[model samples]
Target: MPHTLFIADLHLSAGRPDITAAFLRFMAEEAPKADALYVLGDLFEFSIGDDEQSPLNRRVASAFRDCGVPVFFIHGNRDFMVGRRFAREAGLTLLPEHQVIDLYGEPTLIMHGDTLCTDDAGYQRYRRITRLGWLQWLFLRLPLKKRLGIADGIRGKSAEAKQDKSITIMDVNQGEVARQMRKAGVRRLIHGHTHRPAIHRFDLHGQPVQRIVLGDWYTQGSVLVVTPETETLQGLSLGENR
Candidate 1:
């Protein structure tokens, strides 16, 4: 069967070499067998810049280059800084924040999923400001060391803020989700960010619709497998599916 793969929130970094290794292993094994690979978002915990020359960054790019599959990446809140240079080097196709794709005949809306969390007023406000193109350009123009330091401060504050936010506030809002679906005219939505993985089935104006949330890579490798006949989310132990 021809199947496509979707993943998100791996948050890969030097500190998490185990996760990186697991992901690389997957790219070498499962990814090459897929029709294509879609990295929905947050491939990194925090991406400083495309100009970064870390071994961790290079290794990941190399894996994708060798995967033998067309790779697609959507900018996530954590890795919104991933630019064209890195995409070219990694042989990745960069996708917009909100994208609609034909998934084996289904019109699916794909996102990094942060925009669906309308309840998080603070994060939404921060998102709007930080994503300004000119602002990002200015920030990236700074020395890599400085950019990393600023990213650390921001990530630290984001972590602390999450500690204070209720689970409901951090998760996607049902109304916003419906609105997005309506706007996109899509009955199926797939995304990852909240680290909560599940299939949500609901009715949209008396019609059936589904939302698929991808899992984080903190514990197991999370993947959403889609084929002409089925859509399933699976968690993988480094080398095998469990």
Candidate 2:
């Protein structure tokens, strides 16, 4: 059956070789068989800049290049620095934060899901600052070593901050989700970010809408497969290794 696959928050890095291996296996075994593959966001743990593609990034790009099916990427908060250079090298198309597309006869909206967490005011402010073109350009101009050091520092702080944040704040705001879906005129929405994978059904003025959250690859692998007839979330067990 022709179907599409959605994945997010793999957070692939040299530190997580097992997860990386699993992803490569996925590209080889699962992705190519699908009609199209949508990588919602955070494919890497951190991407300093496209100009700083490390050996691991090169390998990942090569893997995508070999995946036969069309691949699309949405920039997650963690890897928003991925630019045209990386996209070209990886053989993938980069989509905007919120995109609506026809999915098996239904209009579906896709996103990285960070913007929907509007309750996190501080994080939202940080996002805006970091995403400014001028700021990103300035950051990219720094020496590679400096850029990496800054990224590591920021990541550490973000991890610490998450430990203190309420779960509700970290997750998407229901109102925001509803607003976005309505704006896009889509009954189905797919995104990855919060790492809380679940299917949420909403009733909007006599219409039914579904929101699908993709899981993070921190401990196990998760993917959402959608065909015309069915949509399901499947997990890859890490077992004793995790």
Candidate 3:
């Protein structure tokens, strides 16, 4: 079984106990069944803790470490500070922003899609500063308590930023999507950031392609499963049947 997986927007935080349980269950059951797992972005609510010994982080990482498959992670706005330490501890491969790979014999591109928010100049500018190497280094050097405080402050600020942004500015622009699709020479674009889960079929240069938006895993469970024999995108809620 060739399984190329995609999940995003977990936003796992110490505040959400049920989500933590569900995620643990996922690793214990669901993850093992897959040949590979691609966590699109936002695996944590905000992880800047210096303690590699944190119980929560270690527990989550251990699940993947024992899953017996490849686990790939991409950085999202919330958990962008996830560093090499976490990756090494969790036994995950950190994927770059624009990663082109072959899955199931088809060319595919994976991203967090924050760059697609070209219309949101303010947010884009913020992304630039946070991603800066010097800024990250300075931020990480702070004490664990201070880092946690900073993470909390940033989270609150992000909520404010979202409130001020327009819907169109936040979502991916169609033209930009088309341009990237053409450039990558792959019709498939899979990402998760806007928390809108849908499988979009579009015609580009007379060729049909798919743009998959992965949903947030909070009250509902969603995953995009792509394999040679089975390819389907669906949402799973508590009351819904599988």
- Each prediction's number of clashing residue pairs: 0, 0, 0
- Predicted candidate 2 versus true structure: per-residue lDDT over 48-94, tens digit per residue: 99988688899899999999999999999999999999999989999
Question: Would you list the C-alpha lDDT of every candidate in the order shown?
Answer: 0.94, 0.92, 0.83
Candidate 3 lDDT over 19-96, as tens digits, reads 777777777877888889999888888778436367778888899799988999989988888878888888999999
The predictions' CA RMSDs to the true structure, in order, are 2.0, 1.5, 2.6
Q: Would you estimate the TM-scores of all the predictions?
A: 0.97, 0.97, 0.93
Residues 1-242, model 1: lDDT tens digits: 89999999999988877798899888998999999999999999999889997998999999999999999999999999999989998999999999999998899999999999999999999999999989998998999999989999998998899899999999999999999999999999999999999999999999999999999999899999999999999998855422
Q: What overall lDDT, based on C-alpha atoms, would model 1 receive against the true structure?
A: 0.94
Q: Which has the higher lDDT value, candidate number 2 or candidate number 3?
A: 2
**Count of backbone collisions within predicted model 2:** 0
Clashing pairs in 3: none
> Model 2: which ten-residue window has the lowest total lDDT?
233-242
Query: Model 3 lDDT vs. the true structure?
Result: 0.83
Q: After superposition, how far is residue 39 of candidate 1 from its true place, in Å?
A: 0.4
